[model samples]
Target: MADIAQEAGFRKNQKLKDALLQHKALSRQGFSERLFGLLFSGLVYPQIWEDPEVDMIAMELSDQHSIVTIGSGGCNMLAYLSRSPKKIDVVDLNPHHVALNRLKLAAFRHLPGHGDVVRHFGMDGIRTNSKSYDAFIAPNLDAATRAYWDKRSIAGRRRIEVFDRNIYKTGLLGRFIGAGHLIARLHGIDLTQMAEAKSLREQRQFFDARIAPLFDRPLIRWITSRKSSLFGLGIPPQQYDELASLASDGSIAPVLRQRLEKLACHFPLRDNYFAWQAFARRYPKPEEGTLPTYLKAENYRAIRDNAERVTVHHASFTELLAQKAAGSVDRYVLLDAQDWMNDEQLNDVWSEITRTAAPGARVIFRTAAEKSVLDGRLSPALLDQWSYLEERSSELNLEDRSAIYGGFHIYVKKA
Candidate 1:
């Protein structure tokens, strides 16, 4: 919104780095489920990685290239297959994310047809998607998963009803908007479109003139500036550093507000599919929407086309790399995963990458800082064999939807 929030006056701040260092040094760092508790405690899930729609437009993917990604919430994998990659191999250490990925694949492969599929997932405007749980998905899940889905909420509503009541509740970005809406209501701002406004220009103007100013408030800004406040958006320990670095003087709230406002306020409500998922909690009607990648009617056929290229293992990144042939992978989407690793661990990941990267292999990753986390920590010889495109890196970052990642980087293996 404001020249990409990287204006000259904004100094790259390191307080988040200082804060993370202390957090990392603590005993039993990142081990407790309590940390993840912040992620799912509310009725909603946090979001990272903007929607894949815009970024996928840039890839110009072919039938030949294979993809490997972390299966965070599984939205993007289905989105990628919409373009028909040869294979999409998603890996995640978190069982919840893996289960969700599996569920999405299972739904696509097995769900009866587009309208029913859309109604099952796209209902409740996405905010009330839990209703579809009772109607469609819950019955389909195995006993354990069904039990989890059928669990009751404190409000006494079955979690399954959340589909009808909360399609917008699925991921982090939606929750952030919900939180923002709550905060806005507390301040007497009505963000709903039906309340007023006749034209799109009036809508954006209203946001610019009335709604956006609240971000300048001391309390809201202060609360959002802290590193912990962002865990709700699934800003794992690794991405916070880069997110904090985005602001001048380490004030991240303004930048976050700008990008998020873009997600919320910039486009028409119905046409904005991400917002449908985030705000209304439903997929647009067939004429009103283009469903996310995994939800498409064509996905089963698309993913099934290249299914053979992938191999799934119940393992971590390092463990899985150990089993792969050298120089075999082409694209790697490590979504905020390296933050879990310290120096030694990162080196081991890099060693595997160096050994496994084919000539001209492109490795892309998002991080919490503008600087490469692997730079100083990696062996000089290993780092020297690659090309880093700083300017091109900036371009690739342009239309990313999740509005959460701070830095986008790409490294190419030399021939």
Candidate 2:
């Protein structure tokens, strides 16, 4: 009965379909969109790729602020709880993401200690995690969320059992990383060597010696040139075009190579868990490297105490903001979702954002290209209401540990 209910929920995700399907079904672009929609309809990000540390600084988050943000993988929202925000309305088109967000909130509230929280989310492939879920976390979840996790996956194990053996290895992004590892292995390169580098110099040497050559390989260039190859990264056709246009040769290989180079060389591996995930496929052990803000031991007590402030909504960010009163929200974290929007969609979301923004409210988002996506697409009136912090955005974009996005933008609502 739970499985039936879950299947119904997955099939009925009209909002997701509406967001992804812009072209006719028979066209190649349309087919790729549908395929991405299908893959994204399930769990796409086991952990979101954006840097929450940068987001916090961009928003100037405070206890008095009310925030509305897209909830991808739920990590950043939980991290925001550390700030003791007055409210966090987390909206997502994906029901699985909604469930995952709710589950994390419940875990923070119910799980006994910081170690237990780390065990559940930070570590990968622990057989005891399901036991902990059944005993501690499951009972605290809402009925729908509980049913969603209780439902079995295609592997004949309950969805909750993913924690029993590397939950991070189960999602679309996880499989994408795994595929990348396999490809590297086939070419006689060990991707994990990047994680072992002790300094920036070592990191750069490893990238030049081992990783840079992989991008120039004929097979790799061909695979990356296809739009479908990036579905695992949650990049849509429009964003893929933007990414390819950045390279002089108009191939995604050089763009991807540059991004991976930043990921490998810009920060010490000992401090970047994002690097750990990219190269090691798992977060570094506690004394080895850093974890996301939400998973850090020091933030656990605050996150647990403030977990109730977060409310996960299974809907679009625009729809959710439209329902709020004017001047109600103080902060907005859009992630890289704006890269997926068409002109109308961009205008619609920004309209609501401008309408609902409080005095001096801030909005932050990322783009696949090295400029704000809203430059000309949003109506002039709406665009004029916000001040783009271009210099600060560029500075922080470099500081972003994830290093996946081409640009990070900050817009402050004109008072």
| TM-score for each model | 0.76, 0.97
State the lDDT of candidate 2 residue by residue for 1-415, as single tens digits: 5445434654588998788789998999888887777777778888989999999999999999999999989999998899999999999998888989999999899988999889889988778988989999998888999998998756678998888778777688999999999999999998987777878999999999999999999999999989999988889898998998897775699999999999999998888889999999888997688888999988999999999888899889999998999999999999989888899999999999999999999999999989999987899989999999999999999999999899999999997
Candidate 2: residue 323 lDDT (0-100): 97
Candidate 2, after superposition: displacement of residue 261 in Å?
0.5
TM-score of structure candidate 2: 0.97
Question: Which number leads on lDDT?
Answer: 2
- Model 1, range 73-127, lDDT digits (tens) per residue? 6677766776666766787654445555555555555555555556655555454
Q: Candidate 2: worst 10 consecutive residues by lDDT? A: 1-10
What is the lDDT of every predicted structure here? Answer: 0.59, 0.90
lDDT of 1 at 368: 61
Off by over 4 Å in 2: 1-11
**What's the lDDT for residue 274 in model 1?**
69
TM-score of 1: 0.76
